[model samples]
Target: MNVTQFIVDTYGAGTPLVSTAKRYRPSSTATKKGYILIFAHGTGFHKEHWEPIIERLYAHGGPVVEAWAIDAQTHGAAATLNRDAIDEPGFTYSSYHFAEACANLCKTHLNGTRHPIVLVGHSAGAASAALVPSFYGQSRTPPFSALILVEPAIWPGSMIGMADSLAYKLACVAIPRRRTTWRSRDAVRKDLGRRAPWGTWDKRILDLYVEHGFEEDKEGVSLRCNPVHETQPFINQINAVYPVAELDKLRKKVPVHLVYGERNDLFTREKQESLLRGRRFASVIRIPGAGHLVVQEAPDAVGDVLLSILGGLENQRYVEREYVL
Candidate 1:
């Protein structure tokens, strides 16, 4: 699929609160009936990761939805709010900050037309989307009309207060020590193919990840999102509250769709019911044989799910589709 790459300024030149995005829009006639879909990737990933899924969605028969995938602050080409401290170690990565930045970008750039805005986010971005509703409360017209969260970063209620736990502390330490450079992009791909999450990713998606996730350096290739920035959300609990209330607030006003991979270890069936059971406009589904990174594992399947959801939204039916894994 063809795309336009651009940067949206959030806080002017001095601040590092800019966002980089990839956008795809169908021909004018086909786009008249669709909502604007904004995709926000997880921590450490670039907007390019959303391309495969976008391609699959367009390939399948459906309403021609316009889509944009954004690289969050501290990731991809987006500049940091504090340019002077780009290499700082103790910086915090708050989901609230990401949500506000996303809202700013949508309001400033994507809201030019009359289409309803739908925010789709994965992992950390999913959590950020969850927070967006709270930030935009009921007083004013919400910038986004719907939300599609994939394996969000929300932990179980029991673990909400365990931000200082040993496992999280260990992740805080281990994540920062991750390798940031490689001899080349091919070398990075080969190395990541041998790693756990990356090993599970589809080759094309992984290639796209490397293509946008890294930048050439004097020595070799280094991660655009530094380890410090990528690891902040894991260790910092300053913004790690449960999002049940936030989701509740969003469900009342707009459709809230939750998609989880069946093999995902993060979300349990009980948790799904607890969060989405009988809400006025909420639904949940599981993708068979998939995991937390379902977008990378099965872009076509993810795309099919998204198209189905979009169809439902357009028809005001909230229809459900079945995937065979």
Candidate 2:
């Protein structure tokens, strides 16, 4: 299958935002599937980071699938769409805004595809999925059939006013200090290989970051998602908080699955239990020996888990297999 890249313009809260997507169409008509899978990336990462997982999904096919991975506004190829937001340090994005863009993208581009969508997201994108169906208001039916969230960056209502606390303050100071330009891709990779989080990432994922996360410039390659846009979201996490009732409504509309890394500190047992308290169709599974970047560290493993879910969806059965790396 060939992967094609494209872009679509959409309005989010009346503001113009652009989203980029990569499509992998099925090779044979014999295995055509019922749903289109859409993948959304996390903060500071481009849609290309999903390539490894996409490749695995195709190789372990249960049905012919048309899959897409989208880049959020201010990330990847969509970064140039809003120069003002790219330049302004105070400009921040919200989950509702991102959700709106995703919805509009579907209406504009995937309208006649005749496929139920299986929404998959990681980190911040996962949070956006939680708010997509009810973006504008309450709706009886959603566009998606199921949702797979990986380590979503959801915060409690209590953290709404804590944006200016020590953590956000430190992120504000640290993100901008990151080096923006590199002499070459290898140079960028070498530099990143020495950093804590980046160094911990799988080599292929780190390569994708160096490949799609930067833009060519006369001086060298510069980060596409600059520090200003990246740090702004970190400090503005309060804007991402939504009523639990809204999420509950969405979960009732479709099957929602949560995938977390065993070593990830974000999803404590109490937090997971709280999230699954009243949601009957919601389930949780952990990937052992992984952290918040589990998808990156073990795309093949994650891809296997996703395929099982998709198979279940295709056969009208629910499979919540525990995946251990």
Candidate 3:
């Protein structure tokens, strides 16, 4: 796959700029009917984390033209770019910022594209993905033809009390207190390899995180995304619940699919059901031996599921055309 890196200056007066990478097979023969995929990563993760699954998607030979991944202003390469602004005291980042970046990419870089655009996001990234369409306003047509939310972290307004949940505590307390600086990449890799979540991650994803999720300096290497910045979205909780309502609105316009790991660690059964209440989805799938971090834990399974979803969409389009004829 050929890769290209670029930055998109988000719209609005004070929105932070976001970094993006595009990947495509050099020999791809896909035309307008092929899908153009846009991806958003979870909090504390970088865009490169999705590369493994993307590689699998390419190998599956789905109707894919190209794939694009965005780094939230306070995560990955974007975090390095916005260090000054984000370092400011009281600076807070929200899912809205990520959503604005996705909306900006579609309005600018992908403007007037003919291919069907599919937006895929995992965990907190799914919140941002769900809110992307709202940024276009009611006057404009949303760029996405479909959405695939992998273990979406979105919750209804009724679940505002989730701040007291264990997941919230882990995000706000444990993450900030976790080790950040390491003596060397080898040391970091060893430490993470023995940890709970990291140890559970696919080796390829773990390798990607080690490569792209940190930066080297005089004091050794540290996480590219400051732990404080990573906890901001969890602390703010302002935009977290908004995605639920947005999903309700968007489902009528585009097919919205949900993918869950068989294990329900972060989001409990009741919490997951909250997202389904009074809303219709195109499909719901579950992958065994994975949790909320399904993208990192089971990339191959994710790729297989995505290919099936894409094939279904293609068939649906064909049937619709035939009906029109």
Candidate 4:
């Protein structure tokens, strides 16, 4: 394995934002008694967006830990990842599959010998974290030490009515609707979310997207996450190859924390309840007056809650498991 650092460009944060990672050494010995935090970036956002959040976790977390954040496939520097094979003959990539692959990657490449990780994903990433582990393999991981799902956009799984589904279906239409490829970044922005209400992001964040979402197309300028890369993924997700029922299938032992912004239009109160379905085992939080971008909206509140969870986890003592080493 090549142990080095490199950057991959993505549709959202390609040139402007950077997703950088570094490992924290636990100790010389002791089986590396530390936790691992694997982050899943949000839609139209990359890992760099979580830099402030991750810094808060590092600063406040107890028992010491290591963390890494991945740019969601096709969204960040990992944009080129599987680019050539978006709609490959043998490849079937769903959101669930994407999450599983990320977990596998974390297990394989992350510099730690630790079990019982602290898995956290934001927006679409949160949905994946809340749902993927249970389906990975029988008894492989105990549904992560704690799953933190933050303000997932397309949430409340069952509240998915026909109208919303239809809207998503229309978005999928972008797959075959290659009428005129955008030649400039301006064209792409004009088309984003139908240009209605623009995006409810911090103005600076929205500007950053404009800066990164477009490139110098040979014809003029074209968007990187074009029809094929995006529309196909949209198609794949709606028709998910493997649907996760709930967290139970993953493992009941692992706890889950579902966090959302109170004022978030994406994961509204009703939408979150629908997704969670009032599950008893998991924890739920509604950040007061926050929006879809909770971390950026209320960094202090988010950090406080996360640190509280980690603090509780740090105090728990695990019993010996039967194993042959």
Candidate 5:
């Protein structure tokens, strides 16, 4: 697959800029009309984190014309680009910023593109994906043909104060005091490999994180995303439940699919079920032996699920065409 990197200035005057990586088969044409995937990563993760799953998708010969992974303003290369703004004393980040960025890409970079687009996201990225259609309002057509959310972080507004939840602890405790700098990438890798979350991640995903999730300086390599920025989205009380409302509005317009890890590490069963209440979805799947970080723990499984969803979509389209005929 050929990979190209670029940056997109988000919509709205003061919004932060974002970075993206576009991947496609070398033999594929720009004009090919197939599924175009736009991915958004969870808090504290970079765009390249999805590469392992994407490679599997291509290897399976799915009908993917191309895939684009986005870096939220505070994460990945976008963090480096927007350092000054992000470092501002009162600066804060939220899923809404990511939604604006994705929406902007659809309006500018993907405008008039013929391919059906699938918006895929994990955790906070899933919240942003759910909110993307809201930016277009009811009058305009949303860019996404479907959404595939993996371990979505969205919850009801009333659940924000659930301090016992792993998500809250991760945001308010673990992340705030976590080590962010190391003498070398090797050291960083070794350290994280022995830790709870990273230790559980697939080795390939961890390797990718070691390679692309940090920035090097004379002192050492530090996480590209600042801990403060990362924690903000998790604690953004008002924004935490914002996507649930968006999801309700979106369910009628596009097929919404949910992918979850069997373990209830970050979000409990009740939280996951809350997303399904009174809403219709195309499909819901859970990968065993994984937790909230399913993308990292089971990239191959994630890839398989994505391919299956795409296959179903393709078949549905064929059936619709036949019915029309």
Candidate 6:
């Protein structure tokens, strides 16, 4: 499947929250009939991780639909944002920057669109996308037409609260950092290709994984998904609380689609319900045998599910709108 890489250049000051992205458009073109989907990829990987799933959708789905995948700040091809590296003793990794990066993309690239826009995310990326409604609300950014979050890491605290924020900060610091080794890294790469406990995915989805996923020097090669910048704080309850409420408010403006992989260890059903239960225009989808990387684990099924959701949003005339103020 042929594709094109587009740079949704966005930067953040706190960490090396650099991001790059890719998009997959349908091969066949009609007068046009679908929504614009902005995809957020899982952590410890790059945007390319969702390439196969996006490609699969492009092949079988409507011309009315389009899909895209973005790297979290400091991961994938977004190496430039590494300027102010994380060097402090207590500082740690956080997905806070990912949310900021997503907001900037919607403001700079996705704003003023005529078609309905759906934000789709997986794992950490899903966590990032899941925050889109709230994040935009805090910043006065335009709201999306709908949202689709897959097994996001949004429920670290059971509820979105201070304890959750602190725990995430501490965990990013506490997790044992794996030292690099040429032999071990090669093994990790190999393992990533095989079927996960819940599902299967192509290893090639992460050739870009080679960059941050591997650390090289005199030591040769070692695993490297959680770079210092990746570990830096990107989400903060106190700092980003407005966005969370914005997400709630945006529910009044557009439909919100939430999806989860049944095998996902990250987001439980209770958490999924918590993320959208109060919202009027929200729907949750559960994929039977998928995991954190649902798109890769069940590319075909993921594609089909996305197509169906897109069709529903289109049928409802869920068009994207721009803010006048």
In candidate 4, what are the lDDT values of residues 134-169, reduced to their tens digit?
445564645356777777544433455422443455
Q: Kindly list the per-residue Cα lDDT of model 3 for residues 1-325, writing each as its tens digit.
A: 7788878887442645656655555356654457888999999998998898888888778788788898988889888888888788877667888888887777767776667788999988999999988877576556677999998888777776553557666767788787889988888899999988899999999999999899998888889999897776667666678798788878998899999999878777677877888788999999998988899999999999999999999888822111000
Q: Which stretches of candidate 4 lie over 4 Å from their true place?
A: 1-34, 61-64, 87-92, 140-143, 153-158, 162-223, 227-246, 317-325
C-alpha lDDT values of all predictions:
0.72, 0.73, 0.82, 0.53, 0.81, 0.59
Better of 4 and 6 by lDDT: 6
User: What TM-score does each of the candidates earn?
Assistant: 0.85, 0.86, 0.93, 0.67, 0.93, 0.74
Cα-lDDT of candidate 6: 0.59
Clashes of each: 2, 1, 0, 5, 0, 17
**lDDT of candidate 5 over 80-144, digit per residue (tens):** 98888888887766688888888877776777666788899998899988888888757765667
- lDDT of model 5 at position 240: 62
Task: Rank all candidate structures by their TM-score, best first, as comma-separated numbers.
Answer: 3, 5, 2, 1, 6, 4
lDDT of 6 at 9: 47
Candidate 4 lDDT at 110 equals 45
Candidate 5 vs 6: which has more lDDT: 5
Best candidate, TM-score = 3
Where does candidate 4 have its weakest 10-residue lDDT segment?
A: 9-18
Writing each residue's lDDT as its tens digit, candidate 1 over 51-94 gives 87887777775665578888777887763433344555455557
Candidate 3 weakest ten by summed lDDT: 316-325
Error of 3 at 189 (Å): 0.7
> Looking at candidate 4, what is the lDDT of residue 116?
53
